[model samples]
Target: MATFNVNDIRNDFPILSEKAYGKPLVYFDNAATSQKPKVVIDALVNYYMHDNANIHRGVHFLSQRASEAFDNVREKVRAFINASSEKEIIFVKGTTEAINLVAATYGRKNIGKGDEILISAMEHHSNIVPWQLLCEEKGAVLKVIPMNDKGELLLDKLNTLLTERTKLVSLVHVSNSLGTINPVKHIISLAHQKGIPVLIDGAQSTAHAPIDVQDLDADFFAFSGHKILGPTGVGCLYGKLPLLEEMPPYQGGGEMISSVTFEKTTYNEVPYKFEAGTPNIADVIALGTAIDYWNNLDRPGAVAWEEELLEYATSKISAIPGVRIIGTAEKKAGVLSFVIEGVNAMDAGMYLDTKGVAVRTGQHCTEPVMLRFGVPGTLRASFMFYNTKEEIDCLMENLGKAIQLLQPQTAL
Candidate 1:
């Protein structure tokens, strides 16, 4: 087995040192949210402690410092995603807000009656609902790209779904419910071939994998900072420069306007045109620190380690007599969703919690995927780079006990 310096990584996260129910917290709920590193936390504290001021309008010392910090983070985000220009990156609350921003602005402008927007069967509610609302408002049609039993997108069907009238294709780069990593590069390429734009929901993939928006040729990409070890309420939307420049502003507020008159108003450039109001100034500054943390790590080595944990956990958990894994995609990240026969997913989650194991149980915000599989939901145990095979062992052992406890009751 390849060895990782788990102790050193654990030290970076302050919350990992604490006990959950008297046992050391084995955090498997990373798909939902990741714990903040000390660097990120300290950055947040330092921002408020020294440089708390509104940006872009003031020439005062604190405002200047605050504005510099906020603007610097934009450059950081631009580099992080390898966007062509910093102007293409717009700060929003999270992935949800980012998607809604595009739907309302880009969707409203481009989509009309008979226009189709394509989404995968495995999108989170955040990805799905925004487009649905757009379709409802614009009299546009929403088409779903179906997935196979293994939770992989049916690429063969993609051509049929994408026509000249297909205005947009929004897809998740990685499924939060399943670990399946979709071929977003191919998806983007296909959409571009049809002269259709693509929006990639990178909320799950951004944390586990490296991204290049230009390389993928994605029209729009959105991700949350919290999932990447930064604070919440600070996420980014990356749109192509031309597309961003063409779309109308998502909201009417301060900072998004270039000039305003009694009868006419002109919006700002790409990023500022989308970023309305004061924004999450402190969290945005801290997000740069989080990116720094990710940069410090051996990213490829970390991904390899995570893949090992996923494989080991899958093998161990799938061996249990009644356990059925929900997704068995060949190419996956650090998520493992499963259901044990004779145990309700909620009950299983509660049982694991009592044994000091943390797992998420529910639709995982992808109820359509759950309905397609004909299961209520799976107990989703997602891993991070800091997770260990030992932790997976403990989870597997506790899960077995949980199944044993429920089997007799369920049978009777």
Candidate 2:
């Protein structure tokens, strides 16, 4: 494992010191949501405490301060994703909202009858549902790229699926349920070859990996700030500027309009055109601090350490009797999901919780992937930079106990 100042990193998160069931909290549910660092929390508190004001329309000092803060976050997001310009980054609720915005605006605009939209089998429900809705509404066809048992997409089949009829290809940059890191670069290139645009659901991948949207040439990319240790209700959608300008506004409200005439209303530029109303201002401001926190870290080293944790956790848990490790993708982030034979995933999760080790149990918003694997769900132990090997050891110990308790019932 790469040596890191784990104690120092742990101190940045205040909640990590809390006790759950007399045991210190060991958060392993980072894929669902990460624990906030003190910096992000402080940023949020500071915004509401001092600079809270409605943005864009106000000429007052507080309003100008709030607007600058909010727009500064947009610049931070632009830099975080390496977008061509800040105008491309539209703040939304989260990845789901971003996808829905694209589907409603861009999908509705471009997709037509008999056109096809391709997505992978490993997409989260958020990615899947929006496109499905768009396809239904526009009379377009939804094509799925199949995956192997290893939870990796079949590239060979991807070629066959992409025909001249393909309008767009939306896929996850990383699988939330399986922890598979997809080859989005290749996928984007392939789609571009066919004159099809691509939207990458980057909700899971943004925190763990460095992203360069300009280099990737993706048409759209969406991610949640909360997934990367920022506050909830703050996320970004990065769309190519030309496409964003062409698409209509997602929601009509105060700030999105440039001029309101009784005859016809003029909309704002690319980003403000899509972002309507007062956004999650406090959370949006805090997201900039979250990006700062991530930038301060030794990212490659952190990811390397988390990869060690994944390998160690996988090796230790897989050794337990009747434990089946799922999503054994060669390239993955820090997710470790598995099923314990004869035990309900929820029961296992509950048992682990009693031991003060947090884990996510269920289809993890990817029921289609779960169904593809022929399982109800799996116990998922996802890691982050703050997670330690000792926590993984505790998880392994509790998992053994969980299996032992359920094994007798299975034998009966």
Candidate 3:
């Protein structure tokens, strides 16, 4: 088997070489966001340099070119997740907006009072809050599936939770905080048997590895572009045709309309209907570049190298005294959440930062996860394909020093 080359692959990202605190930057916070590639960055610049114009309206050259680029990204995203058609893809601000869109449109339409919406304990706030709001507004009940100590969900509980009152089953594809890869295909199949639609929060999963909406047979799947190599303020929601067609428009404006006047206004078709207003023309166009970049790369090799980092880091970091690794699931990916016994997670985070290691600290938008583990928060070292084992060693070395400083002082 040909091994993935970490050094050569790192060169594609220019920001990786930058320094901080007089040390080379070791970004271990891929879950929050990933560094953009030259392709995506160049596309952003190229859009403004040439194809800068309002899309979908103007018949002029720049507008037509810009519109094609903007609309083409829908197809790119459609193919990216193996969605049935471009019509299934709706570009939103981020994962948060995508979730809210479904909750407002579909949940408001289908879910009703006394009905139940089931989620898991490991879900991020993006998944939880929207459902909570929908429940509150619709007078529905929000149910949670429990997880074991290893962060794996109790599938037995899920079967019980999928009751007659259950309107929808929404969960995370991968835990952002726990790094647990949920059995989404199995989960979806189980939900489908109950005739419950499933929505996957793919914000964390899409960037780390490959995903197929069809293979999972999910009713709706949401992901953030920023979590991958694409720009912030751009993300996608993939819903099955019937579900999207039935739901109301999320926001009403120019692009989303067919005809509008003082009287009743007609809306556009599926994807465009949910997508109102002018939209982020440039970033949406650039998103296709990010997709293209990921598609062009040796994806299997990239994923293999990421696993290598996870394995190497897990081995080294766990060996340290007072260092406890949370979420020891066998099927985890790209995240190493831990806490030093005596050290505050933020303290460890600040110390790690001084050493030029950028790792995320605290709840990571999954407060329920912290509560489940009975901790305040965790210091998370989330990896990416571009990260190196050498960086992992640096993190380990710095962590040892930080742990020592945080240790109780003894008589000298």
Cα TM-score per model: 0.97, 0.98, 0.98
Better of 1 and 3 by TM-score: 3
lDDT of 2 by residue, 196-252 (tens): 999999999998888999998999999999999999998899999999999989999
Q: lDDT of all the models against the reference?
A: 0.91, 0.91, 0.92
Off by over 4 Å in 1: 1-4, 409-412
Which pairs of residues clash in candidate 1, taking residues 3 or more apart in a chain or in different chains? none
Over the stretch 1-412, how does candidate 3's per-residue lDDT look in tens digits? 2356778777878899999988999999999999998888999999999989998899999999999999889989999999999899999999999999999999999999999999999999889999999999989999999999999999999868999999999999989998999999999999999899999999999988899999999999999998899999999999999999999999988889999988889999988999888899889988899999888888999998898889999999879989889899989999999988878999989999999999999999989889889889999999999998889999999999998998776689
Q: Residue 299 of model 3: what lDDT?
A: 90
Our tally of clashes for model 3 stands at: 0
Candidate 1 — worst ten consecutive residues by lDDT sum?
Answer: 1-10
Q: Candidate 2, residue 327: CA error in Å? A: 0.4
Model 2: residue 148 alpha-carbon error in angstroms: 0.4
| Residue runs of model 3 more than 4 Å from their true location after superposition | 1-3, 410-412
Evaluated at residue 152, the lDDT of candidate 2 is 97
